[model samples]
Target chain A: MAEPARGAYRELVRAQIRSQSQYRASFAMDAALTSCVSVLEILAILVLFRVTPSLGGFSVREAVLIAALCEFAFQIADLAVGNIERIAEYVRTGRMDTVLVRPLSPLGQLLAGDFPLRKAGRVVQGLALYAAALVYAGIDWTPARALLAVTAPVAAGALFAAAFVAGATVAFFWIDSGEFANAFTYGGRTFGTYPQTIYPAWMRVLFGYGFAGYQPALALLGRPDPLGTPAWVAWCTPLAAAAAWVGAVLMWRTGVRHYRSTGS
Target chain B: MPSAAACPRPGPEPESGSDFGSDTRSDTEPDSGSDKNTRSAPDARPAPIPFRDSARAFAALAGAGFRRHSTYRQATVAGVFTNIVFGIMLCAVYVDVAGASGRPGGYTTAQLVSYVWVGQGLLSVVCIWAWKELAERIRSGDVAADLLRPVDPLAAYAAADLGRAGYAVLTRLLAPLAFGLLFYSMYLPQRAVTYPMFAVSVAAATLVSFAGRYLVNLSGFWLLDIRGPISFWMLILGPLCGGYFPLRFLPEWAQWLVWCATPFPSVFQVPLDIAVERTSSGVAAATVLLQIAWAALLFQACARVQRRAVTRLVVQGG
Candidate 1:
């Protein structure tokens, strides 16, 4: 994380942005389409609520708050590190060899390679939902609560970013691991978006309710944990995120060491 | 659905269909004698490929596609695992939603559970997305190689896709369904005949799905990139095709319009409804026939477009 290496990463990202922006119309259309997908997903939730008054004891507004938080965190993580999902292709095409020879971190280079700036549309939509959820949930915004609101998504984003890294690591061991990785990465988003009480006990234990952003979301709304976890768990996002990050870094290092090049 | 660019990309125009190579002549049967003459005429239209030739090639290509897909053992396992996970999440949410509302979409809790699981199982079988092979080949100009073969590219690709679908039915479709049955109370068909009818409906649905994807891939001949159309297609078609939930969840008028106006319902809802016996026998038969009609209509469109696209490729010398 030296300054020069950090600048190199910035330059790589800038090059991608410039190339993407050069095609202004396509970029605009991609951004607009990304937003449209965001709207449709939210609509799916709203449509479900139309059929029933509540799901897992949560009203539509409450569920939207959880979903927004999870999606926001997911989008941020996806924007930051999701491109690693392409590791299968990189490995298959022997691009990983080229990446390994570079001075910069392979993970950092892969992330900066195709940054998908257009995903900002979903990020904006997610923030809009969060702001609306804040109003709709009608919480008594204390200073601590206010602080949680700002930091929750960042911490959750770190957690989801870790999930992305950890998921991508599967590719190094097994090249065709994208769908398996999605089982948690996207699956975790689906799990986190709803009240954790609705899931069977095993899912909650397996994916873990905390890293999925549910604990923090519940904390923000001051909702009691139906599974009866302590209130202190709400403040554990940073710690959980750090642990997950350490685990993911170790997993990624192991995967990198395990790599056998697709020798040409 | 429409793009600004409809003309072929600028490239060296092949002066004749002969430029496609010897396969064109070798494959055209002697029985297509008069039709063969027109193909060699200057600025003449290529004759429609004979049906028998296409059918034979279709079977072979489909088998090849099936075998090709079967080789991806790890991917199949991963895909099945992913489907099961989604099935569980959707079933949990849907069961609660259905349980609370007392059959919101006229489906009982059991029926809704069946709907969710079957939808998940069929998600890959029907394949609402994840098809970019043809478009990629088109972009790479590899589709010209397909044209160089004796078989029609449309039939060849569609057959291969059907083969892939066959592989999915054995692995992706059955695994989640077995998982659903293991853990949940699933709906069983009321009548024995429903099974065969449902199978037919699913087959037609696969054809309809293939035709839809084929046309989308064919768009690559004109557009610089097919990503926009592909995304737009998925954005609109995914939910309409019942990958999200049952179309019965839609208001009655909208549901009626979707069934009447689009092929989306034929892809998932029709077969699933038939499988669950949600509709009466008469209505189920009608929907199956409706799916067949859509399949035929879509394949006709595919053939027409494939012809035009091959012509474009020839003229552009791709």
Candidate 2:
């Protein structure tokens, strides 16, 4: 028999989506605001850009492409999984009680809620910038390469969700604040949005432990190894995060056990 | 959490919510079955720090305050990371603007890009968001509390500020620095003399920043809406201080205006200058002296405000 909780979560998603649809103007306004503002932040950089400029070793235009690539990758992280992160709150605040008592698995129900319909605005801006980069950077695009490029983001998106899940799981036991986990999840995104070569050593290690910081978009962008990371190392970057994702989940389950004792 | 300041700064009074402890105490408080569950999760959970009551009890209270705050930590973490991404996006724009073809003041496109990363990293925690611990005391009509205390109220405020500053710098400043180092080809200052100078400059900035913020916090004692004053301060301060972008990139007149008009230059420009040794040794000493002057003046202003508030209280109610 199907669990009622799963159905309820579906309803929650449906309701949120419908509510967002009803306030169409508000949704559009917020969307437009975010997109426009984010773009302006980028435009500021463009104002400072001089033509045919060399940045470090990379051309100004190439840096733009890397920037946009990371932006697109970052947006993928931001827009894709609005629900999973909130589930930690559900678990922490005793809200999970309602979900658990119902027939559905709390995780299953959680994964179903929080449809990020509005982030389309963010996506539009990111893609627009990305397209501009394509024009400016003048990269050769092919069917096979395009397919790989697309997969890079999708896989990266999945990795982002996984990181959230794992990070949130830590919050379950600690049961106080989940900001540190956010540092890894959102922090990684911010760090990743740029070419992964501008920061210092400790930060690089945060990503390098498993290509934890650099891999997802790196895979999509063919891994711009500003640090001259080995080809094999670059290839393994996304997988490094993938490992963290799985590790985080296992950690979450263990934390849940702690929560059951402490929080329940 | 009680600041005793009535209208210290222009912010909302937050008295409605109860303390976080009242929500989850397992003593006489209702023990939902969930309490038992916590007992069994040994390795998975941290033992609760027992609350105590001493002058040192404050240390525990701060710990508790942190625990109470952990619930929001997840949200804060998300906020910071999102901020970092925004920073990255901002850096990209700057990188794009500075091309191999153009270098400003001998800084190439790449160095400028790296510079934004540093600036963003700095702003995550260290900025002139003012509070008036002194002003707060005055506004609260607790100038009486100051007269009665054994130690100076100023010293008391400094202790508390240092404690909280310790917490904020970890989450806000250090975390992003970690991200920057890992992700970018960071430009580090090479000189040893610059290191000590940078430290001294940072210390000066901190003192000045503390004085300004403490003054702002004090406004809460007098104003129902501190946001107005805060926003006004931020609106002018954000750009003038070289917080939003590098001072070098702002137009020359604007840059000169910031340097001459406000305390903004001291907070940011001096530190960077010292880091790069753009200022000669004598000039650096002069800069440090200026910071000491500002700090003394602000501290004096705060004490004067306190004395007036205290005198008013004595006349009316004391």
lDDT of 1 by residue, A1-264 (tens): 999999998999899888877645546766777666545665667777878889888888888777777777877888888778888888767889999999989998999987888777878887787778788778778899999988988888888889889988998988877788877777777777777878888888888635555788788888888889899888888898898899999999999999899878
Across B1-318, the per-residue lDDT of candidate 2 in tens digits comes to 000010011111111133422322323232235455555664574434222212333443344444543444644465456446545555554554454446554566556544555454445334444344444445445555445543345544544444444454566556655676787666666666767876677667666666666566555445522444454454445545655455666657866777666676676556655654554777877887777787787778776765554444531244
- Show the colliding residue pairs in model 1: none
Taking the candidates in order, what DockQ does each have?
A: 0.40, 0.07
Per-residue lDDT of B281 in model 1: 88
> What C-alpha lDDT, on a 0 to 100 scale, does residue B167 get in candidate 1?
90
Q: Which candidate is the best by lDDT?
A: 1
Q: Give the Å error, residue A130, model 1.
A: 1.9
- The global Cα lDDT (0 to 1) of model 2 is 0.53
User: For residues B279-306, what per-residue lDDT tens digits would candidate 1 score against the true structure?
Assistant: 8989999988888898899889988887
Return the top candidate by TM-score: 1
TM-score of 2: 0.53
Top DockQ model: 1
Chain A TM-scores, per candidate, are 0.95, 0.77
